[model samples]
Target: MPVSAAALAESLGRVPPSCGPVRLVAVDGHAGSGKSTFADWLARGEVPVVHLDDVATHDELFGWTRRLRATLLEPLARGADAEVPVYDWVARRFGPAVRVPCAPLVLIEGVGAGRAALRPYLARVLWMDVDQETAGAAGRLRDGPELDAFWARWTRAEREHFAADPTRPFAHATVSRRTGGYAITPGPRAVLDPDFSDTA
Candidate 1:
């Protein structure tokens, strides 16, 4: 059966606010695992999303913890709108900043969005539930051969990052692609953690 983003959005909104008055939720997974697309569809231009891609740079793919916390999380934690800096992939530099309102439910969407440092501020984490090899092949195909070098570096870095701080084990939900839409199922954490199990 096809699923609708409306129902998912409604359910996510109910997750308790872990970041001050805002419910900070993370959509994390391997590259090309559809984290961005799912998050965009789920948001439907209504919910606020802070993309990890914007916080990452060519030199520092996973070195965005401090920046994200400082620019986005801190403000949202203070019940204020966040002014997030956008990185220009083409220019390979920081571009303009975008203001993300402190909405009732805010999504942190991108690869590694559910890293250890950000979990405390997140009410829930949704993993894409796709294998790294499959996701990498799809990502490479989407980006084309022109970005082969970049993908090579990125894949290695992603592998290292995940090995050190895996997100799947800590995810509250696992999102998998389904015909016409996606399926959201309880993840390991949701099954293992008493708090999540109680709520479920």
Candidate 2:
């Protein structure tokens, strides 16, 4: 059976704590895979989320790994509050620093939130189970022709990046989009030949 969004949120609250007192959950997948929307839905209860989009910049999309480790991960791991850098999409630069308190549950959503370097800090990793082709098509349509070249480059980069450091193999949960909502299930790592059914 598909886990309801409410049930998933409750589960997040119950996840065992890792770094300090924080139960860090990472939502990762191809760009335009509805990770942000799903993360928002998952944050309905008391969990606070750290959107990687805010930490990533136009020039340094995937390069924010070091920054994230320095500003967010390291601090949280040490039971200290972190001041994260917020990137301005329109301005194409990083804005003011925003403080993130070490809460019981905190979600980090982005394309590579489940990267090998970050998995150790996360209590659980959720992969938005959408095909790369579909995600790329959606991204191209969403950004339109103006970003055609950028998308082309991004596609290749994303493929290479994930190939070298894939996250699906380590994911704890998988989620697929439905008509009006989403369908959630434990990942292969958490289940044996799990039968999946759609939900909306």
Winner by lDDT: 1
- lDDT of candidate 2? 0.82
How would you encode candidate 1's per-residue C-alpha lDDT over 1-200 as one tens digit per residue? 43578877877777689998999999999998988899999999999888888999988999999999999999999999999999999998898899999999999998889999999999999999899999999999999999999999999999999999999999987887877887677788873232222221
In order, candidate lDDTs are: 0.87, 0.82
Best by TM-score: 1
Q: What is the C-alpha RMSD of each candidate to the true structure, in Å?
A: 3.3, 2.9
Candidate 1 global Cα RMSD: 3.3
Instruction: Provide the lowest-lDDT 10-residue window in model 1.
Output: 191-200
Model 2 C-alpha lDDT per residue in residues 49-150, reported as the tens digit of each score: 899989877787688889999999899988899999898888887789988888888889998999998877888888999989999898899989999998
Clashes of 1: 0
Q: Each model's TM-score, in the order given?
A: 0.94, 0.89
In candidate 2, residue 34 scores what lDDT? 87
